[model samples]
Target: MDGGVLEDEVNRARLVHAAGLVAPDDAQLAGALSASDDAIAEAGRQRRILAATLGNAVNVLNPSMIVLGGFLGSLRDVDRDAFDDEVRARALAASAENLELASAALGADRLLIGAADAAMQRLLADPLG
Candidate 1:
């Protein structure tokens, strides 16, 4: 999903967590799904913002697929239809016509390894690292 999880909208939940709005570890967007109404609402808000921001990428990159992983998949799994509808609505007609989103096979709890994998990609690309 590119920068979807890194955007301000998604990060807002973390900000709330820091401000003591949600419970501990709520920034991860997975654990508190049913633990608190505030967390659930925050997840909904993040999903909407991710859709809007992710659509920006679709227009520029025209990617055929988006692979959701970690807590990102948690948000998608919460409401698939609504997530798809929002993304399709925000994305440009032509860009979204062939768009598809898939969950990463390793599932939603692999954030650490996933991040390490991403970090390794940079070194792989450079080769001089």
Candidate 2:
């Protein structure tokens, strides 16, 4: 609907609490993914929520692959197996069977690179554009 609840669950404030970070951005996530006990527990909880959300999407769309970029890739990288297990548990068997979760090949710069590629393609197609 309005994304109010999802936004509440997946924002910097809770992440800050989870990771015990002062910066309240990437540090929040990094801290959660750290090797500390608090990190393990918090990271696991976050991953479960993320996986359940993905599983709900899979049930609706049955997509073959889900590509994550930016911080999302880092989130998945923290505990891929655990995330996969959570998704499998929540997703329909048929939908989860062929699903693949992957990270962007271009890392964090993929959007800029894609924009440049699009511009080049357009320029080559019409040199005056």
Candidate 3:
């Protein structure tokens, strides 16, 4: 509700009341992995979101493989099985069949590489401009 915005005091208060956190940092969120049921539920929510997004992508792009980069790629380190299961369940059989999901192999350099690649693509598409 309210677009999940935490801008207002009421929303932030509600989030704090519900999750017992006021803007948890990455380390805090990561620590939650083994600390509480809420974290598990949040992880599940993330998996579902990923599943839906990837499912749509599969239907549209029909990519044989998908590389999860950036923060998304880090899910492999958190709970690979759950992520895989969610994707398998949500994506169409034809779309998911033979689909491969791999974490970015570029490690910390992925963001830089991705940015450079995007820039190159844009340049190539308008070489004269």
Q: lDDT of each model, Cα atoms only?
A: 0.72, 0.72, 0.62
* Residue-level error in angstroms, candidate 2, position 89: 1.8
TM-score leader: 2
Q: Tell me how candidate 2 scores on lDDT.
A: 0.72
Ranking by TM-score: 2, 1, 3
lDDT of 1 by residue, 7-104 (tens): 65576445357334554442344555645776677777778777877788888899999987756767777787889878888889999999998667
In candidate 1, stretches whose alpha carbon ends up further than 4 angstroms from where it belongs are 1-6, 12-31, 108-129
TM-score of 2: 0.74
Q: What is candidate 3's lDDT per residue for 42-125, written digit by digit as tens?
A: 555555566666777887888899887644654444777767767766778888888888877886676689899999999999
Off by over 4 Å in 3: 1-32, 112-129
For candidate 1, the per-residue lDDT at 16 reads: 52
